[model samples]
Target: MKLAQRTALVTGAGSGIGRAIALCFAREGAAVAVNDIRRDRAEAVAQEIRALGRETLTLPADVSDSVEVRAIFEQLTAQWQRLDILVNNAGIVELEPSRQQRLIQAHMERLAGSGAPAPLAISQSITDMEWRRTLAVHLDGTFYCTREALKLMEAQRYGKIINMASVAGLTGLAGAAAYSAAKAGIIGLTKAIAREAIHCGVYVNAIAPGFIDTPMLAEMDAEMKRLIALQAPIGRFGTPEEVAAVALHLASDDSSYTVGQVLSPNGGFYM
Candidate 1:
């Protein structure tokens, strides 16, 4: 019960990594606030915690929407008054390797042949909706949620913020440009926040997981799955529980001395 009597808000807690983190924290005795864009999913997770004899609050809101993110915090304040931990873990990944490669190659060719301004023509092959949507869900959501969390944390002079980055961010995954870019932004945000809040006892950090056996990896074919597992020197993909363990450490007082660190549990994939 490392988190006994603590209060935490985990976004996207309806499924996958977020769900695992929520359950793990609840087992460790944290009164968790389970958040998901879906009301039903949020309620389900909240119920699971209650069954464990832990207090819980279900927050159903799209974190990508700034308005909803603010309201979620307001609701949390009414229940707990203060927050001890926050895990910004909501994200989406689209598996379109060929499409991603096409965009990247086209972008590179244009940059080389036309001396084009990089920012003006970034990934023309990718649609505006796809790019914006991915960033909105991951990067924008993190910023909005963190902005709100910082208010409560800075005032109290103690808080833990754990962001969900991916190995794609550390070493761009060929088929996941948008996801990789968004996660990379999260890593940068964590470092900046850690530095800014260093004197306030608000520790910010990120976890970069590699090929975890979660819903994100469910759609891959057997061959693709095999390749993914073998990509890691450990000869297997990781588990959500394994990733949750790292969250426990970062969200606890044990990480008081750590700041803006991006912890990678990649099974020796990237070194």
Candidate 2:
């Protein structure tokens, strides 16, 4: 087991990419801390880790909330004593009900097969409230978790951080300006931290995925998805398991010489 005896924390572990990463880490012999917005979902992932005979702790918290993020670290310290790997995977693309009800309603109507596609004009039509909410979760949340994890990693003089970005960050995806901006920031942040912390044996890296077959993409129109898949030079969408393999590589000693790099498993969709 590459990660035997190490400790890992995977945010948004209730499902999708996060769940896959959490399970992959556990199988590689890492004690995993699973965080999700839903308590039930967190517990479910935690149970899967336990089934592998690996230690696990599950707590539901909003990664965008500094208070909650700090509490998660405190609890992790109490349980695992140290964090060897941190996967900043918690993120959301949906707008809050209170802030963008009309936009969401129109979008949902389209998804329900009622009308023309309601594509939000990312650069001009987005509201201030919607922009803030998306950035709060994707960008601010990553900063909060990383800031807290940094202190712990610095003290130990060893660490591995895997920040999740997307192809949107490299080549902005239409209709997702906020998400694109946030992910781009993550790549910049990863490089900045690596330069500062590398001498101390703390490595920071990022992963940029494209057209992954995950639940989040389920909302896309069938034709849209098919067209996107065709754009992949590989002729197919990637799987969570495939991404998890890359995460496992970065989290282990195998990646000791690699730092501040954004690894993309986009099937040649982006290079």
lDDT values of the candidates? Answer: 0.89, 0.87
RMSD of each: 5.3, 5.1
Scored against the true structure, residue 174 in model 1 reaches a CA lDDT of 60
For candidate 2, report its TM-score. Answer: 0.89
Candidate 2, residues 111-139, lDDT tens digits: the string is: 69896765554457678987898888888
Clashing residue pairs for model 1: none
Candidate 2 global CA lDDT score: 0.87
Q: Which parts of model 1 have CA positions greater than 4 angstroms off?
A: 97-124
Prediction 1 TM-score vs. true: 0.90
lDDT of 1 at 269: 82
**156-263 per-residue lDDT for model 1 (tens digits):** 998999999999899997656788899999999999999998789889999999988887767665656776687799999989999999999999887878899999
For model 1, what is the alpha-carbon lDDT of residue 62? Answer: 95
